[model samples]
Target: MKIPRVVVGMSGGVDSSVSAFLLKKRGFDVIGLHMVNWDAQEEGTSQCPRSKDESDAKSVCDRLKIPFYTVNFVKQYWNDVFLRFLENYKMGRTTVPDIDCNRSIKFDIFHKIAQEKFGADFIATGHYATTSFGDFQQNRNDSQEIRLYSCADPLKDQTFFLCTVSQEQLKRAIFPLGSLQKTEVKRIAEKEGFHAVATKPESMGICFVGKRKRFAEFLDEYIEPKPGKIVLSNGKTVGNHKGVHHFTIGKRINGQYLEERSHLGYFVSRIDAENGDVVACEGSHHPDLYATRFRIQSPDWIPIRNPLEELPDSEILCRIQRTHPPVPCTVEKCETSRFLSVIPRIPLRATAPGQMCVFYTTKNECLGGGEIVEIQDTLV
Candidate 1:
C-alpha cells in the first residue's frame, strides 16, 4: 500500500521539528519544506539569518531521514505581505503581518505548491490551532467544511493568526502541534534525539525584522520620520514626537519631551496622520483611552457564510490582540455589508486601527475577523 504524502513546513523551531517527527512516526511519506520568506542578505544582519534556519531545518530533516527542500518566497512575501504591511504603517495603523503571512504565504502559496507540484495530500505547519471537519452540507454540493478551533494550550492558541484562512485552504492543512503543549513538544524532540532544537528560544516580534534593531529604527529605514506635535485630548500641546507612524494606539510615550508629564503616565489616545499629531491621555485608565464600540472592515467569516443576522440576537466574543482575553460584544450590521459595528459590553483600551478584531463562539471556535476601521468614542 502506498502511504499518503504530507508536506510539513519546517521553521527550524522546536514545534515544527516535533511536527515532522510525529508525522513520519505515523507512517506517512513526510517531506520538509523550509520557506525563505525574508532575504537576510539584503538586510546584511546576522539577526534572523535565513541561512542559519535553513541549515537547522536541513539538519532536522537529515536526522529524521526525510527528504527536505528549500523554497524561496521572498518575492511573493514582498508583494503580498510586506508591501501591505508598509502601506498600513504609512497610513498610521497598527498592522499584523503574521496574519497576512499565514494567509498568503503559508496556507495559500505553500499549500498550492504542496498539492500541485509536490504531489502531497496535506500541508502541515507548527501552528497551535486545530481543524475539525463536519458532515457534508447538501446545500453546498455535499462538500465537507473545515472548522478552526483553539489549541489545547489556551495560552499558546494561534487561531487569531489564522482567522483569514479560507475554507478551501483549511481543507488541505494540518497542525500537528495543535493538541500538544509547548513543554510536551520539547520533551518529544529531546526524547527522539533531536536535542539541537529542543531548547531553542522561540522567535518573537516580526518574523522578518527580528529583534536586532529597535522597531522605530527599522521603520525609519522605510518611512521617513515626520516630526509632529504631541497633544492632549483637550488639544493641549504637550510636546513634539518623532513621527505619528512611530507610535501605536494605547502605547505609552517616554522621552525628554514628555518628562514633565511622564509621572502621569501618558498613553497614546489617537494619531492624526493628516495633521501629524499624536493625542495622548493621562493614564491607562483614562476615559479617553477606552471605547465601547468600533467598526471592522472586510470580515472573513469561517465556514464561508455570513452570520450577521444571528449576531444581533446573540453575544459573540471579540479579541483585539493575540494575547488578550476575548471580550463579550454585540455585532450590529452596518449599512454596508462589508463593514460591521461591534459594541463591547465594556469599554476597551487601545482599540487600535488597522488591527484585526477576531470574533469567536463561546466554545472557542473562530468565527472570523476584520480590520478595525473606526472607533466610537463613548466617553465624549
Candidate 2:
C-alpha cells in the first residue's frame, strides 16, 4: 500500500507546528509547506515579521525531520484577497479579509499546488475547524457531503473564517487541531520538545499585515485618505474624519470636533462613501445599530445542490459576525436568484455590509455563508 502524502501548512506558530508533528507521528508522509503571503521587508516591521515566521516554520520542520518548502503567495494574495478587501472598504463595507484569504489563497491556491506539484493526497492546516463526511439524501446520487463543524474549543473555534471554504476544498483538507484545546496543544508541543513556538504568542489583526503597524496605517499605504464630515443621525455635522474607510459600523467615533459629546461616545451607523460622510448614532443600543433584515449575495450552501430552490422559506441559524453567536433566522428567497433575504428572530446589531453571514444547522454544522450586501433596520 502506498503511504498517504500529507502537505501541512506550517506557520511556525504552536498550532501549525503541532499539526505537522501530529501528522508525522500518525505514520503519514508529511511535508511542511510555508506560505509567504506578505513581504515584511517592504513594510520594515520588526514585530511579527514573515521572515521570523518562516525561520520558525523551517526550524519546526527540521526538528520533525520532515522536508520543508516555502511558497510565495504574495502576488496571489494581493491580487485575489487584498484587492477585493480594498474594493469592499472603498464601498464603506466591513470586510473580513481572513475569510477571503482562506477561500482564495490557502484552500484554493495552496491546495492546488500541494496536489498537482507536491503529489499530496491531503493538505492540512492548523485551523480550529472540523470536517466530516456525511450522507446527503438531497443529492441525486446519494453522495456524501463534507460538513464543517465547530472545533472542540468553543473559544478558539474558527468555523466562521472557514465558512467560505467549498466542499471540493474541504474534501482535501485536514485540521489536526480541531479536537484539541489551546492549552492542550501547548502541552503537547512542550512535551514534544518544540518549546520555542510552544509559548509563542498568536498572531492578531490581519494576517499579512504585521503587528507593528495599525490597520488604518496599512490601508493608507494603498488607499488615499479622503477627509470626510462626521454627522449625527439628526444630520448635524459634529466632526471631521480622515476617511470613511477608517470607520466600521458600531465603532465609537472619537474626534476633536466632537469633544463636548466625547463622553457620550457616539457609534458609527452609516458610511456615505460617495459624499464622504460617516453617520453616527448615540448609544450601543441605538435604533440605527440594529437590523431586522438583511440581504446576502452569492451564498455558498454546503449540502444543498441548489440553494435557491431548497432554501426558500427555510429556517436556519445565522451568524452575522465572526464571534457572534448563531441566532435563529428564516431565509426568504428574493426575486433575483443571486440574493437571499434573512430575517433574524431578534434584531441583530451592526449587521455591517461586506461582512459574511454564515448559516448553520441546529446541530452546529456550518452550512456555508455569503457576503451581506444590504441591511434593513425595522426601527428606521
lDDT of all the models against the reference?
0.83, 0.83
Question: Candidate 2 on 40-72: residue-level lDDT in tens?
Answer: 655655354777888999999999999999999
Q: List ranges where model 1 is wrong by over 4 Å.
A: 134-142, 259-262, 310-315, 378-380
lDDT of 1 by residue, 112-201 (tens): 888887898878888898877421111222266678889889999999999999888877777888888898988999998877788777
Q: How many backbone collisions does model 2 have? A: 0
Clashing residue pairs found in predicted model 1: none
The residue pairs in collision within model 2 are none
TM-score of each: 0.94, 0.93
Give the Cα-based TM-score of candidate 2 against the true structure.
Answer: 0.93
